[model samples]
Target: MAILSSNYSLESTYSLESTYSLDSIGLHTGLIKCPNCGQFHSNAMAPHGHAVWADMPKDTVDLTQDLIKMGVYSSEVVDLAKTLTENQLKVSLSQFFRDSLFERSASRNRLILEQPDLEQPDYELNSSNLVDRLCLEVVQEAGGIQAAFAAAFGDRQGELFENTIKTGKFNRRQFLARVLTVAALIMLTNCQKDNTADLTSDSPNDLAQKLEKNQLKIGFMPVTCATPIIMSQPLGFYEKYGLKVELVKMQNWAQVRDAAIAGELDAYHMIAAMPLAISLGLGSARFPIKLASIENINGNAMTAAIKHKNKVKSAANLKGFTIAIPFIYSMNNLLLRYYLAAGGVNPDRDVKLVVLTPADMVIKLANGEIDAMMCPGPFNQTAVAEKLGFIHILSSEIWPGHPCCCLATGQPWIEENPTTFRALNKAIIDGCNYASQSQHRPEIARAIAAPEYLNQPESLVKAVLTGSFEDGLGNTHNVRDRIDFDPYPWKSFSYWITTQFQRWNLMPSNVDHEAIADEVFLTGLARHLAKKLGQTPPTVILRKEQLKYDQFDPTDPESYLQGQIKKHGF
Candidate 1:
């Protein structure tokens, strides 16, 4: 007597790839049988050219109307209607409406009283099989037999249920039965819930399964350098592709680089210079480190306090001033040294180099403790906003376009969990794309402002999200344009690192930099994404190819100067 239906059409060709079909007799019109399941039911399989109760697409609404007439709240009925299918709608509607009929009432009552005899325990059920059990429970609770039959087989409940009963396993009857049972429980409970459960599921195992089993702990030095990776986590890109990312913040690049080399950290928002230093054992560690994904390039700026603004314009103006940088071998040092030398001033003699952390650089500049320092993003924005100082030269202004920050994971982590690496890489790429677009700026800004990381005001967040860089020079520019977001050019950067290693005596003169870069970043999961997405991937720099050291090595002290000359016909 339970009405079931479908949206299938008799005239339409069925996509029988996974079709389920059933047959049943109608309770009301006395039709012995009908094609109620699959294509036939959804396609208007009704008698006398009139549609069966559940044969129509909008049958659920009609059923809700019947429940409303029976004094159910319109809202509550509508809520319940969400669980009801077209056939279930029609069958449930017909049953309740015809409950007033004496003959049908007895039949409905008898059907309920004569519950089917128990069968042999051929099927086993457990927590692992909860979905199947829950499904049946749902069907039974959904108005019991009628609801179950109507929801699954539509008007063909007799045939569908009979077949399923014979099979004694998963079939339309079992699936519908379980679905209705759970839905009915939910409806009767009328449970009020909140986002805590809805937004994030209680299944930690399931959530964890959504990410890679292995871990990659990348470090960041409070500077805005780690923006890409941080942006990826909140964007759900990391989890979508299965990556367990541990973002650790370090106090300085020294710690960041040290942790990376010691394997205490898998990666960090690394300086192009640091990778070179690590690959060659330059400043501290002698271990060769690798670069997987370049996070950003050329947003860094060399800034000075407002009081020293008049004392310096370019490196030439700093003839005798004490200039502060984050560290001795820091990118700030290399860039300033290279730039001052390019401008014809000896970095070792013309300027007294003072070393400090990025945070200290800001404080010192504010307190007039340091003359100028190289800083990035919000810090620079903060300093400039407070009238702290003007930027004598930004990396993007001096170097124009070059790689700056990178997602430098340890070589060992990259070897395992290749899938996870690809996922993380894809997420980082997606996050960068999201961050770059103006329309997505607000979304990215809101995400950064949230508590997970980089908690800042909306305006400040957007300033960085939009890639704006202002060095207090009264000249603000979009820094993203000067950034090579995908700077995986293995040879370009690897050779540069190798040369720095040799220059700083960190690596042997003949150590294969290109081979090391390839082993770390160029191979593995990232390649799959590049192929799948049709992206021109980051090039794997290798030692086999001749190094392009003259083009990028800061140790040459005149590369940028030569670059400026080459571009301007100097």
Candidate 2:
């Protein structure tokens, strides 16, 4: 019986004429050639009709013969043949006919066993067994045939295959390259699923034993600036690593540094430039320091109150106006100057910068106490929502990319308790990871802006979490980049700060930028924690580069002063 149906496409691989043709071999009996498949088939049916074929057991040949007699075939072999005939049988022939006589014969064919190439002394006694071993290994390595084909053959395999068939040996360079590529790909595939990093050698309690108890008081600002430290302490991560952590809420960065300089606070979150500035005695606290790790990155906003809205339209409009900032040496000051200069204004001469806490700045800005405030998160969001200020500058856009916060301790404290630093670093790293995850961000945001912290509206809290804040110029940024906490703390960021200090004459140019940056910080501690946690600790980390202001020569007083006056609306 020859089957013909319209459901099957004529584009099938088997010749259509053969599909309409009749009896030849045991399996081809009575079937006709299909336009796609030049083979005989049993019964033709519509797409939904399955009357000609019925499922049958693999070992029952009588069932198959009986079905053939009845013009209905359904044994495993006949069903498979019918399936292949009805649809495009796209498969490796070896896999398709695994139970067939041809497959059994091919498996039995062994040139090595028959020819005894094993007589070669160089070949091992098990060399004849290697084919099966190699096939298994290939299956494991390739994951499947498609991967094997893609790796063994180039992406454009048709062309390469033609060339290889023409030549005796396949292109060695291409083959070797593909092999190496496959090997690397397999390694990467295995690495991504690895849970080794998740399993720490020491328990949190054991890790904590490495540190001293209750002695380390860390001063952190109340804003989202100190979030990692806050999250770390409350989450019991600090305790897990043997830290008796007292999270001191400082009013501002200046006070935090003052506490650090005076040996009251062991550590604090600081602008990347703070250590260099402190080492040079540029600020209120002139203490030598050792940075532990990066704390956070890119979350500062400069804003102007509506009361001063008419007074400062752009960076150029703030030439003579007094602006509130946390510290003169902080990124707030540097970034403000950077933006003003970009707008053709010199911050040094044109603007009267008033130092104030971020909270106080918002209050002052709301009441028209200050023209503008360069403040960090949560508060920045509050200020904007309260219409206390329009965004004047966003640090992320100005610098494009850079770590914003560095966890630094007084040099004296680090020297006294090395293990404590390491333990704390691990906890902080854990906290950073926790805070960056999408699932944890909402809770982190709410926790940071809780009643005890900023005590702001939940919406404002969510805004900070989403990194949705306005630049004074009506630009908005949604910051989702993770906070990198476990990296070489003293690297290019310190050098950049040093260079800026020199460029703006914030510090003497001759000072060794490298020495200050390369100072042995607690990066070893961070690495130990990372190794324990199975993460690759950062060897070198540069804070996001500082934004470039409009190119202005600071040396010439005339150019500097005039640039400030004209650009910043002095």
Candidate 3:
């Protein structure tokens, strides 16, 4: 019997006369050639009178024939066929599929595929509409058809599927049969557990007992400085440490602070000075935050509007102009202030410093709302990419080897989950080591540029990470140290940051900078982890930092601050 009529034009459908001889297969039998595999298989009825193929292995076909003798419909054999096909599907489909197959397989049979109730809503006879209905019926529980396509195939294949669907490359019969086959395959496989186990010397139960938490939500902003934290998810660094981490992309520094304070984020990517600020309750409630490791160093730049290319040649020229900073507690603000103070331009009185998200800073600069912006990459690179601004000065020029961002967590959470914390820090340190290599920067940029992470153009991100970029002034500069990763959390960095706070009058003068720096920056932990990871950390925690205007001795931060006050007259 003919299972269903083909909803395809005569020119599109394969000619049975030339492709196959009907006399050999017998037309009356419910058998048809699968256009996908070119193998004959038994056909069954699907929703909307579509044909579903029972394309099983020879042994499974014999088993189905045995069941057929017992009066079972061929549709029941479709389940077994699906199981075999799903087993043969490649694992590189998508991360979603791997997670779904391994995590939610036990409840696979319960997946309810909702049928479209609308009859002839967009022309039922249309081939495109027929395939759309088939997709809807199969993947309705998986966030509709497009999401299913993404989960079943990675980004590249998903795009191909979209293009093919749009161009109506597959007729209704071919598309419906494939959809039914895939749907059945996934449904059956969902009931089975993945046999491959990734374990260590300790048993599963022992490992689970040792770690207080294996799952965590790490918050991060969409900036290139958070490259290590963001790339760890896609690169399997977190998985290597036996962690199931969900990277929550936050909007702004304030949102990250609020989320971390509210206990919504177990850990987060924070500006180097934020831990000190949060611990002292400067801009947030008293939350004892610990700096695990410095994420990136010197990944910031002062970008000015294109029109101000010649007008704002130096920091002194920035006087009487408005500038944008990522946050009040960020290195962008501190470094910009330091650079301006050295140029005899008081950041507070000379240039207006407005707080804005990095993403919005580019827009505001393009709109001529802000004359300049001192923020982290690739926003500065983005402005250059769009020809809205030119790189005025890199933060490395202001203070070489300055700590830009850090990986931080609540001190209480760390104490509660010590083992998990160690594992998490190890993963972050590994990611940092990976990102430090100049050869890996291009790959790192591509991995983090996905919509879930930085969500910027790949070319723009590559330019920032690779340190080969146009400065929007017809100059291509290649500076490898523009952004570099080092996991060490130097106590000297904290001392310098606190000294800046004192210099800017952001913190009390008598606030025990040494004690706070020692308590907030986990230098000891970072040193230990770095050594354990086979990386040589600095033997001493204190070091002298040379800035554009003056030198900062960590051992004598008080003297440095007093001298800064004497020099800049702050």
Q: Which numbered prediction scores highest in lDDT against the true structure?
A: 3
> 1-570 in candidate 2: lDDT tens per residue?
323222332222122211111111122222322211222333231124444434442222333334445654223323323333212111221222232334455543322222222111111112223333333333334465455455334454344333332231212222222222222222222122212223245565665454444357787777676778887766677766656777777776777677778888777877767766776688554668777777776677777777665666576777777788787777777767767767766677777888888778888887777877877777777777766667765666666555577778776675465556556666677787666666677787777776665667777766766665564445676766522232445355555555556656677647654446545344434554565666655432222233454433211223333464465554
lDDT of each: 0.50, 0.53, 0.69
Alpha carbon lDDT of residue 4, candidate 1?
A: 28
Q: Candidate 3: where are CA atoms >4 Å away?
A: 1-209
lDDT of 3 by residue, 1-570 (tens): 112332322221211111122212311333443322233455442223324224422343343343334443334333333332232222112322433455555532211112322111111211212333334433443455466666555555443444333333232233333333332222223221111122233444454555667888999999999999999999978777677899998989999888878878789999999989999999779898989899999999999999988887888899998999989999999999999998899987888999999888999998889998998888998898888999999999999999999999987687566667777887888899999999999899899999999888999899889999899889999989899999888777888899889889888888676678766877655665665677776654556688887877665677788898798788
Q: Is candidate 1 or candidate 3 better by lDDT?
A: 3
Q: Which pairs clash inside model 3?
A: none
Worst 10 residues of 3 by lDDT: 117-126
TM-scores across all candidates?
0.54, 0.57, 0.64
lDDT of 3 at 394: 95
Which lDDT tens digits does candidate 1 get at residues 238-289? 6554456777767777788778877886556777666656765667756656
